[model samples]
Target: MTLVYFPSHFKRAPAIFFFAFFLFTLGVTHFFGGSVSLLQAGESKAGLPYIVKKGDSLGEIALRYNVSVTAIKKWNKLTGDKIFEGQRLRIEPFPLHSYTVKSGDTLSEIALASNIPVSRLRELNKITGDRIYTGQKLQLVNDRKRTEKPSVHVVEKGESLWDIAKQYDISIAAIKKRNHLKTEVITPGMTLSLKEVPEEKHAKEKTDEEDPELFEYKVRPGDNLSTIAERFDVAVSLLKQLNGLKENRIYPGQTLQLRPTSLDEAVHVVRSGETLSSIAFKYRMNVSDIKRINEIEGSKIVVGQELRLKGAKPNVYIVERGDALWEVAQAYGMRVEELKRLNGLTSDRIYPGQELQLGIAPARPFGTYTVKKGDYLGRIARLHQMSVADLKSMNNMKTALIYPGDQLKVTPFLQQGSEWLKISEINWDDLMGSSGGLKKITLGNGPYYGSRPMARRQNNRRYYESARLSLWNTYKRAQKLQAALDRKIAKMGRLSDCLNGWHIVIDPGHGGLDPGAVVANLDGNGDKVYVVEDEYVYDVALRVYVMLRLHGADVTLTLLSPDHLIRHSDPPVQTFVNEKNEVYNSRAFNRGNSRSHWPKGGRNGNLSRRVAIAENAFKNVPRNRRMLLSFHADIDHSSPNVPLVLYYRNRRTGRPDRASKQFAKAIQPFLGAGTVIRGQNVFVLRNSPADISVMLELRNLAYTDHAWALRFEELRQRDAEKVVRGVVEYVKGKG
Candidate 1:
């Protein structure tokens, strides 16, 4: 080694020069997207490990891994962007446990792809809207499911696959494949395992079959032709042609069919000067067929426009009010099974204005058949998949007697059950007492409770007094609550439409794999009943969602429950189950309520997913117009657990936001006596960009308290109304 002697001043100058040179190199490399960082020795290796080298920076690494730079900082305990050469860094939880937003990304897509519940994502990220942007950082969490016995279901009598699926919220396709079921037929006493996933997937659904995963795209607030087409992976031109769109206008709630073309059809591009007639002639098809398939009007054809050729439009029939599958099939002279197959219907449910596809061929002669030689009534009924009795009824035949030359009605009308008047049996002995049970109330020409003939004076009313008292008390409570709400609303003026056009998101707390809290007991009939936190909260959330929507606010739900399309509960949901079946709206609940299928993390990821969902959902709306209502129930072992309203506050200031406080106060009065109003920096609420975020703990599930609030449908409905009234009141105050 050669050594040069130098003075102390000169040596210090050389060191300073070298330090300056190093800073310059780093600045140039980072700005130009060049990797220059080198890993330093003794740096901790935690999370997904990475080594720094030439042309490496936080931004560059994040982009490569499709993660947010902030996430890298958090995982690596990084305080700044400065990284040294040879420094070992933690880059994990990046691609492995976190997701970065991409252009045109929706909360649903991220939830589905990452196997994290969208609600969990929203909760973690504190998202209030469905709108997400490119290059945003999102946290992923582990789906936490309680350990329990292996999930197995026994077939019950009178239960179909559809019924079982709806009850469990799992797709039929998933269940069938799991149990190796060859058809949708199962017998009682058969036990099936619902836990294990099939290694080999079944054949995918055809273009026309209704896909259980997703059948149609329900247009959202800001959807257009281009966005819808891209999301469904179809061409814009093809979408327009298939949906019969003459322009690029669509409204929210419009159902757009993604796949309508059959495998037999081919795409044909319209050349300049070519008319629909010319195209039909070239393809050996009729002009009418061309027009129908292409959704074309008149003879105008644009250059480079794509049109489906040789595609015949399947016959479509509009379902009128009160129309049933049997009626439609009978009118068209087709079998019910054939009609179901043609329209991809699984159940007998039909709503007014629903479009159903009829078979391609012309309808055969209806309600009449010419008897021929060797033809029997039984044979004709068998051919039509109808019962002999049904055929006889349609033909108005008294018996199976038939003549060879007689014309018989072939189409059978739907069987109607004879309406038997309901006879309510009254037990006079139990209702009346032998003594003077009704002496005071009975009408007579003598003193009220005093006298008459020995037999006629007897006023027996066994249950009359007690029953009357009980009914009177119940009615009084209901009347009191209604009056209180009325008085409250009257003070606020005409505010029925206060929520008009506002964006509201209702989130049910603790769902899917996480049941939150479980209270098991027996019902009046000695059958097991559950007051599950998630189940009860979901029902209440659904009720609020419906009420808000009816008030003209654009309302949506953070998670989806079984039979979710039901806006009104007919008999109301009186029972709660401890099934892990609720899913964040965009992903399958079986995707493990995201089992977040993620590697173990610090906390359950479901809430974060929910917060993220809310954030993205409210992203497009103004902060003032955005609101999130998270519904929950408390398990109180002591003390009266009246409804509790928690409003979001800033931790530093120790005070709630003005809007959130107002919202809480407006709702406080209606939430029953002793309604507690709290202001705190709640994780779910504080993260929301919305001006108002309130968490409503609707009921106290304790034996001694108001536990019936969870088990009684009537009580639950009342609670829902109370919360809705509060919201309306808040909007009124703002107005």
Candidate 2:
């Protein structure tokens, strides 16, 4: 009497027809959209074997639990809504279909709904830790008879033992133990004994390949198999097969067995054709040491196994009773500010026994100076190597207030990117060249800015060139910043001819239920305020759209503002928007898509719908003429020094598109010199129709200083302008 749920698209129409008829007979009718309406009721309660009290009816119970009356009736096989006291009913679902993990899904949540213990769930699935991928599959029931079903996998043409074991997410040692094979030799038509397979997929006559049907899962991180499958429009069950994951449980290696490893630094993931000796050779460590470190009994290793290399130590330190951040950082040859930043500490406070991550940052980028009596911002700026602005920006200072014992950061070597841009973005070299032709009597003694164009026009081009020499002498060493100031000579076309009618889609990552990287901060009034990912990201994206539109490019924003244009300030007015007001609107961006096409949902549904919007906007448009820039503020993983940028990973070869790579490089210099360009198989980039697409994590919001900047319009505008400027440079470079 267990009910089968079908996904949206009206799957199994005949079953749904009978279900509709059954509901009609019960004097209730229901409608469904986007596949299974039962999923809307959410996962079933783990509660089962219900002891029905007096006056309890199936309809009332269903209403209370937000489940369908039809589901309740079918689950109990009740002929009617009638019930009696002491009637033990099976309330939870019987395990049948495998559950695919999605973004933001937790194992405890899944286990509770499935009415199973967390420990038993781990044993049944064979996965350690809560790290499950989207599209991962999970087996819910504990039926030993399911494993007794001769779950043999027939060797395919040119298949290896490793391949078969990995395909089934079983251990090769377990296979060898089960089959009693000493050697790794096998032939076509030979069958391998697999440790696990679902009971429904086992067939005596079918000694063919792996089962066609499988279940994947959603995970907390959202970067799991289910999300991967959802992004690529492929079956997650198949990806599990590819990864040698059965029931969404990943063995240490796809085919080989591995001993448990500690959460320490210097772990190596075993690849195909690698053994202990090969891994030892790669890391230049002894094989005996490798075995001892990982606690392996033999030299045998498995593919995808995480082996701790020898002599590797844990990258964490336990705070002692007398240890302060300054003392600890100085002891480790690191800066105090960096230590605080790494641990996300807003104030310089420490407690004993608290663990801190020893980040891979090389000796801190900036030096710190302790404040003395009668010290002020101007005196400190001159005394230290950095500017007053740099000092204020780095410490998130609202005013020039400094205490006697305050440890202020001095970033002379350009740790703060925005302050450096303010000084270096001027055309210093061009000014040096023009200064040679200036008449001696034409210039004044004061510093000159070319802001007044009318005066220059009236003076017959003789104005301010003398002051250029004054400017030149002050900034003669500007060429040292050539790494960041690349493409200084390139023309950015005209403001009105941005790629001659290019179509751009600016997607602000995370919305609604996915608040993304939330941080509690304070506003200018010294009142508590919240900084959220969706709010600031939308403002940045909105700025990019406006800047691109001014350059005569067609721009589309995947999200709309409920507060309209009030969200984006021109002269940097609004500081922090705690509201999550950006809603999905396909028709709002491009006219081709309809308003009703997007459904109101949360979690990963928001991501998929953005990709759909990009695909629609670029339909029939030339691939080169379209680009997608997904702006997401990173927390925890981003580097303190530079922002993170990534392009799409090709599904087959695992390489980024040539055009996308070019686009990524063009914008990277503007973000910072050390900004890393990596490849992420993110759903939006992997699935977008546009060929040139990139996701930019503009800043590390994990640091309070960085998160504090997002609250103000000035910082957001700075981020947006740099991004738009980089795009223009990319277009110019292509030309």
What tens-digit string does per-residue lDDT give for candidate 2 at 581-651? 33554434222222232222344254777888787887867767898999988663213223567788776
Worst 10 residues of 1 by lDDT: 1-10
* Top candidate when judged by TM-score against the true structure: 2
**Clash count list over all predictions:** 57, 23
Candidate 2, run of 10 with poorest lDDT: 26-35
RMSD of each: 31.8, 22.7
TM-score of 1: 0.32
Over 4 Å off, model 1? 1-496, 525-528, 563-574, 587-594, 597-602, 636-639, 650-653
lDDT of 1 by residue, 1-735 (tens): 000001111112222122222221111111000111111000111244567777778887665443568878887889999887688877553123455676655675455334335677788788887777888877754325312322344454566887666645569997786665779997753544445532322224343332221324556677898876644444465456545567888776455554431111244444323467545644456888777654455765543244555333346654432244555665566776787667655434333224567767454444466775545554455334343444675666765657778887675322222331111121112221212222322322111121222322112211011111222232233233323322332333222355766899888887655666554332333233345676567767755765565555877666653312212211212343344445555432224312363111136564666676777777788768989898888553221224667888788976567677767756664453235566778778978667788988777443212333355443455567667767776687677
